[model samples]
Target: MKILIVGNGARESALGVKLQEDKRISKIFFAKGNATTDNIGQNYFESDIVSLRNLAIQENIDLTIVGPEAPLVDGIVDDFRKHDLKIFGATARCAKLEGSKAYSKKFMQTYNIKTAKAQVFEAYHDAIAYVKNHDYPLVIKASGLAGGKGVVVCEDVLEANATIHKFMIDRIYGDAGIQLVIEDFLEGYEVSIIAFSNGQKLFPCIPAKDYKKAGKGETGANTGGMGSAAPSPEWTAENQIDFEKNILEPTIFGLQEKNLNFRGFIFFGLMVTKNGCYLLEYNMRLGDPETQVLMALLENNLVDTIESCLNGDDVELKFSDKKAVCLVICSGGYPQNYETGFEIKGTDKVEHSTLLFAGASREAKRIVTSGGRVLSLVATGDSFDEARDKVYADALPIHFDYAYYRDDIGKF
Candidate 1:
């Protein structure tokens, strides 16, 4: 059967690789795919997902998997359903889980899901005053989409006030800055749990821990992501249970209670503290680097797993015992100002790892940089350290003029 996948990032490239592994799939088509994906299947760049939807209907594509949050949040799934075309993703209503931090926080409270104590604010001056009155070190979040750069952890009232001005007064995050969620910061280890849902049964993938800090040693401002390792060492058995009891189960119930009809992947950002697992945030779709590593660890037929979930069939996901690690090569000055269109080199030399292109495209038979996060190098080994080492080794060959990567991913 022919399959259509949405997106043009490393996550879509990785998904293309895994989706092709399913015995039932005969052809794979990508919507606006990148250079790495071009090698795996056909890339459609004529228009946008709407054109892809028309193509899917014309070709009678069996299934479509969405890889990004923007389309999902924009009601692509709803549109596809209106045409009677099968697509995998949450509807616009369900997308509020990630589209608005305030909505998600309220949902957590409505369901009694444990999370940071927070309040939402619309006025910039009011938010600044709240920060001044509050104690030091609070989490300030822009309520809308910022491609993961909207949240700031302020260490002092001074820093908090500055960040507040950056978001509220300066409008750094654009429309995403119109509102903010100021919450009490919790100290703990952060782990992300990705799960497949059919608006009913939930299938959790192997836990992955993402390093959000821009620089090594957890310094600098937060970017989309640096790197990640699967089966995070910080995920203890006790916390897993707490997550299921307090966060996971309650989340599913709340979604169903709202008649959200949410289908597709959900990412639960959790912080395991001395008290318990606190739901940090909700991402309506899979995490980027998280998807890169998780795909490496996935041992099941990806098509069957997703189709089964979509059809509401009893399905259990299979995963490899081997450890998986992903290293992201980014353009210099990324998560900020960065130039693209530079010719890249050394990717052909990478042999031991799976190279998935993110911010890159082919120009005149040459692979060139195209986005902020350029590529994802993933490898599996007997252990996390070994896998991380292999990924770094493979990353040495792929070079761009302003490429920079963190050296300490998966390092405890």
Candidate 2:
């Protein structure tokens, strides 16, 4: 089978590695892939969705998998299906769950899904007034996609005013902030559960925990993700049962009731609190650094699992008992201003962990930083300590100008 993966990041890189394990897969292709992916499959440097669909048809791709949210939300799957191309991803209408926070919040409310109370606003004055009346420590989020950097936790009216001004007035996130969702902050640790859905049932993968803060000790602004680990320490068997019953089943039922034929990944961002788990947000596809670690712990053939899910067959996803850890190496000043093009070294020397490139390109036969979050090193072991040790030991040698990484990953 020939497979085409759409995206150009570490998550796509990891997908390539996992898909390759399926011996039935004879060829792999990437759409506008990065330096790391170039080494794993045939890279097609194209960005247009129509052209990508044509490429899939041209290559006779048996299945095309989408790895990024932007394209999926933009209707890539819809476009492909229109041409009778087999693709894996949610339709644009269904993607609204991730593309628009306001829309998703409404969906949750309608389905009675457990989530924080929130109000959506379109006017600056209305938002300001709403914030003034709300309690402190509110979460202000852009209605549209902001690459995971749209939400901010405001501690006071002053901060809330500034964030609202930045998102609505200053247009920091452009049209993404044309509207915003102001919600009460849910206090708890976060767990990311990605499930394979066929519009009816769900096959949940191992829960993952990711550090979004750019600085150590959870300081600084949020980035794509700093680091991550699989089998989140916060996820208990009881939590699993509760999630499947209260969250997963309801989500599937809601999709079916809404007539949304979703056949792709459903990412649930949950905040486990003393009260219970509250849904934070929904993502149409897999999370970045989280994917790096989950791919390491997954023992099932990804292609088979996805196909089985799409067929609505009873498929049990298998995962390694070993714990996995991922440490992200980034260009300094990431999730904000930072320079790229710096030559990356020691990637070839890292032997203790697996290297998945996120933001890098080849120049003069050498790899150089091309984006903020560059790559991730993932390691798995019987224990989290062993995985963390392996990941850190291998992460030490990688170098780039102004490169930085969090030191507290997998500390739990």
Please tell me which predicted candidate would have the highest lDDT against the true structure: 2
Deviation in Å, model 2, residue 344 alpha carbon: 0.4
Candidate 1 lDDT by residue in tens digits, 122-169 = 998888889887876799999999999998989999899888888888
* Model 1 quality (TM-score): 0.98
Scored by TM-score, the top model is 2
Estimate the overall C-alpha local distance difference test score of candidate 2: 0.90
Clash count, candidate 2: 0
Off by over 4 Å in 1: 46-49
Residue lDDT tens for model 2, 1-412: 9999998989999999888788899889998788878888889989789889888988899999998998999999999988988888999998999999999999999998889999999999999999887888999999999999999999999999999999998999999998999999988899999988866777889999999999988889988999999999878988887787777778888998999877899899999998778899999998898898889888888888888866777678889999999999999888999999999998888998989888899998799999999998899999999999998998888989999999999997
TM-scores, all models, native as reference: 0.98, 0.98
294 in model 2: Cα distance from truth in Å?
A: 1.2
lDDT of each: 0.89, 0.90
Query: lDDT (0-100) at residue 351 of candidate 2?
Result: 90
Models, CA RMSD each = 1.2, 1.0
